[model samples]
Target: MTVHLVGAGPGDPSLLTVAAAELIRQARVLVYDRPSMDAIAALAPADAETHVVGLRRGHRALSQPEVNDLLVELGRRGDVVRLKSGDPFVASRGGEEAVALQNAGIAVNVIPGVSAALAAPAAAGIPLMLRQNSVTATFVDGNDDDEHAEPPDWHALARLGGTLVILTGRGRIRRIAAKLIEGGRAPDTPIAAISAASRASQQVLRGTLSTLPAPLPPPVTFVVGEAAALELTCTSPKAS
Candidate 1:
């Protein structure tokens, strides 16, 4: 009777909220994002109808319109669950889908989950904030604009002096970091590229803007801040 917007929480099934998990297990029509991974799909009840919209691309995922249409049509059925990767409300464009369904006279509910902006960095042992360091946190989506995208207004963020987490920012990482540097952030500012976050295969690469050209894995998350530098001290020493 309701169209629920559920957050799959980064990539870990265990991170899903109890309510979100319940909604998925009880769902009969599960419209999901392929990026959500097998761990998330396993949550679906045995009898549910699962639609793997982005299966072809692996977890890179579906176009917004396709995901929107699926959610809206499923809503018309009166009991559908629109599953999202990471917290549905984060950079997820969940609001857009919710608005579309509501405009079509469909009731909607949101079940929150851990967002990559937070989980990714935490997995690398980088606290987004600390008492002696950053006191505030700002989350930005690094969706590049035309021409490889203009970077975020790094000057403004530099002025604010807080923790910065950039989501969907893999492609624009170098640009974003450069902008922040030009905007007055330290060139040695700490950065962690957390990819496939929260999963067993998750990888974290720590570097400064000067050393960022090194190789990295795909589907990554970028966390930028002076606080991020602590990742070195926070991480457990590796075996010889």
Candidate 2:
């Protein structure tokens, strides 16, 4: 039996690849995360056994050691499907899990899916790599508990004029922007907040580093730099 690490994409159900959809339909047992799992589970076989791995707000989750053991144990008994939000390996910890399974002598493969880092800005009409707007880009998870204790070399990113995409940063956007601006990013540097992107209800908000909202951004994805200058024409930005 093989272990399949699948990507649930960002929200829109139709975005699941044809192969991934078929696997979901045939899986006998599936393991997934909470709240985010419902939409993807709806596509699973009616009789599939579902295991929910709930992560409390800022609380400890199933330890990686526990998860690795579970995969080894489960893979030995039957086929297993490990579903993840967005792309499996895109900052979702799926890679680490996949590696554990492989090291345990289990066959494993990852199914690619749409990631919010790219989809969020697309739904907002912003090209992450616009020829005229930006030459390079980087992505950071702002939701990290210690995002900037020392911080990445903002000076380097600023010098190269690379685009910065931040995910899970709902709480630290204002501070992040300040650092970038201080390092060299213009205070007026273009910034956009995208939430629930790629779905019918996708929303976006555009402003400058200096005009960010008071409460700061959300678990949403952030796009900054010249790429922020792309003329996004998808859904209009929600009123601030």
Candidate 3:
């Protein structure tokens, strides 16, 4: 038996890769995370066995080790699909699972999907790169542990020109923004806090380094840069 580790994209079901959709259709046992669960689960066959490994802020339904064990257990029975939000390799622990599965002699297939680092900004009408505004794009994880473990070098990041996309930064934006400002980033640098990106409930909050809204909802994507201020004409209302 084989297991497929798939990225479910940034919430918009239509954004799922063609291969991801096909795998869901053929899956006999599906393991999924919280984001975009309803939409992705619907794509699976009616008889498919589903296991929800609820992953949320402040609450983890299943530990990574547990999920990996479950995948190994399920793979031996039938085709298992491990559905994760965003690109399976980005932030999602699909790589760890793949390693575990491989060690157990189970075949693994990885299907890449759109990551929110780029999708969230585009969906919110914020271009990440532009000829004049920005020349680079950088992604950083703002999870709570990030400040203590493998913290980003805000001073160096400030010197690098481009866009900064922070994922899982809802609670750390103020502190992180302050650090960036202290690192020489302008206090008035444009920033956008995008919540529920690409979903019907999506919301984009625009402000400067010192003016971003407090307590932004979880699962937010923060875009900070000159490019964050440019709203392209082709952006749709649904992006808001």
Could you tell me the TM-score of candidate 3?
0.90
Off by over 4 Å in 2: 56-60, 143-151, 214-219, 229-231, 234-240
**What pairs collide in candidate 1?**
35-59, 145-149
| Pairs in steric clash, model 3 | none
Clash statistics: count for each candidate: 2, 4, 0
Per-prediction TM-score to the true structure, in the order listed: 0.87, 0.84, 0.90
lDDT of 2: 0.76
User: Which candidate ranks first by lDDT, i.e. highest?
Assistant: 3
Over 115-200, each residue of candidate 3 has an lDDT whose tens digit, in order, gives: 98888898888888888888899998777564336877877887785899988778778888998898989989999888888888
Q: Judged by TM-score, which candidate is best?
A: 3
lDDT of 3 at 35: 46
Where is the poorest 10-residue window by lDDT in model 1? 231-240
In candidate 2, list every pair of residues with a backbone clash.
125-232, 143-168, 170-217, 170-218
Candidate models: Cα lDDT each: 0.78, 0.76, 0.84
